[model samples]
Target: MLTIWGRRTSSNVQALMWCVGELALEFQRHDVGHRFGGLNTDGFRKLNPNGTIPVIQDGERPPLWETGPILRYLASAYGEDDFWPRDPTRQAEVDKWAEWAKINVAMAFTVPVFWRVVRTPEAEHDHHAIEKALTALESTLAIADAQLSEHAFLCGSCLTLADIQLGHVLYRYYDIDISRTSLPNLRRYYDTLTERPAYQTHVMISYDELRRN
Candidate 1:
């Protein structure tokens, strides 16, 4: 069995969890980081010197950190090349979308939304920052909407690693209260994602608590 260290609420951890369920791989998960707070301890550091959540120990192999790397490793090792692409060009395309989500979409939209709803105190919340993030996010989503109009999934016909990576972030965006932007294609794609049992079980959650605090 594999051992994973991270709290359930962490988005990175959620990505790993969703992957495990999608692959039907059995594993053990330990709650750490954030309110759980074992990340800084020496015992935890030995596994992951950076003290980040979602580190995985695969049998006797050294533990792996960083959510995207972990996802790629898992797909390569156990996903029968279905989660990831085997063809060089297809792989490159998947990698591009995954990287795009991390840098462009995640940084500009997801982080700010998460911070505003989950981390920031209500009294001190930065409305301007939130609005700016929302604007940037809406614009970026328009691109995704157009892309999705041509294909059912991010990297092509099938649900590849790119979908998994972007879907995790989309969960956050879908939950956030934003304007009525014309994103019919993105909306349809998101609806399809929710219909999957794996997504419903692992990724879907109420934003009420995150918003309330």
Candidate 2:
């Protein structure tokens, strides 16, 4: 069984777990980071000196840290053709979007929008900064919306690793309090993801603990 170390409430962890669930991979997960706080231990540090969550050990081959690499490792090992295409060109096509989502969409939303709105205390919220970040984030979402309009998923008609990279962000994006520009196709795409059991199980979770922190 695959062993994972990360807190469930963590967005990165949620993404990894969702992909594992979608692939029907048997795995055991340990809650760490955030309120759980196992990040600083000597053992955890040996596993990952970077001290980040969502690290995985696949039967002692080695511990893998960083959400992106761990995810690609899983996709390469377990994902089916539609999920992770074998052709280099096709793979690159999907990978580009996955990278794009990671760099552009996820990065833009997490610290900029989500952290600002949810993690910060309400009275101290930076309205100008939040608005600026949200506007930037929405511009990127518009690109996804246009692509989703033509295809059911991010990279194509069927779900791919790109979807795993991008889709996990939508739960917090839609649920959070913010002024959002209407993107019907993006909304439809997210709604479709909600119907997936993996998406619902791993991504749609309570942030009450996060709020209390």
Candidate 3:
């Protein structure tokens, strides 16, 4: 069985867990990082030098770190040709969406929201930073909403790795309170994502608990 090292609440870790459920692969998970705090130990660093959560070790292959790469590896390895598109052009489209999620979406939206709402102390919170982050996220989400209106998934009709990666971030957005943003298409897409059994089990959690930690 594969071994996943990270706390359950980490968005990156949640993405891997969701992928595992989607593929129906059996694995063991260990709580590490954040409040758990085993990441800096020499044994843990041997697997992930960066001391980040969501690291994974397969039976033979070297351990993997970072969220997006881990998702691609699992989808390609265990998902066969199902979750990933076979055609080169379509595969490129999938890659494009995944890349967008990492660079534009995760950096601008997920990280800031996580820091402000979960990590930072309420008294020390920077409202201006949160506001700026939210504005940037809303802009990006509007673009996604428009795209979702045209296509069933990020790349096209089929659910691919793109959806898994972006969907995890969408989970975070749903928790945060946003003002006056009209994103019907995005909302519909998010609802569809939540309907999946894997999402309900692994991604959806009470915002109060997330904030409390």
TM-score of 3: 0.92
Candidate 3 scores a C-alpha RMSD against the true structure in Å of 1.9
**Model 1, range 1-213, lDDT digits (tens) per residue?**
789999887777877888888888889999998667999999999988998889998898999999889989998888755468788887888889888777777777656767785567788778888888788878887887888989999867788787887787778777765544778998889899999888887788654544445
The TM-score obtained by model 1 is 0.92
Model 2 scores worst on lDDT over the 10 consecutive residues at 204-213
Model 1 lDDT, residue 187, Cα: 87
- Mind giving the per-residue lDDT tens digits that candidate 2 earns over 36-78? 8989999999999999988999997899999999999999999
Give the C-alpha miss distance for residue 103 in model 2, angstroms.
Answer: 0.3
Assess every candidate by TM-score: 0.92, 0.98, 0.92
Tens digits of per-residue lDDT for model 3 on 1-213? 799999888888888999999999889999997778899999999998899989998887899999888988888788856478677887778888888877788777766866786667778777888888888888987888889999888877777888887888887787665553779988889899988999998999654545643
In order, the Cα lDDT scores of the candidates are 0.81, 0.94, 0.83
Give the TM-score (vs. native) of candidate 2: 0.98
Q: Return the top candidate by lDDT.
A: 2
Q: Residue-pair clashes per candidate, as listed?
A: 0, 0, 0
Better of 1 and 2 by TM-score: 2
Model 3, global lDDT: 0.83
How should the candidates be ordered by lDDT, best one leading? 2, 3, 1
Residue 84 lDDT, candidate 1, scale 0-100: 87
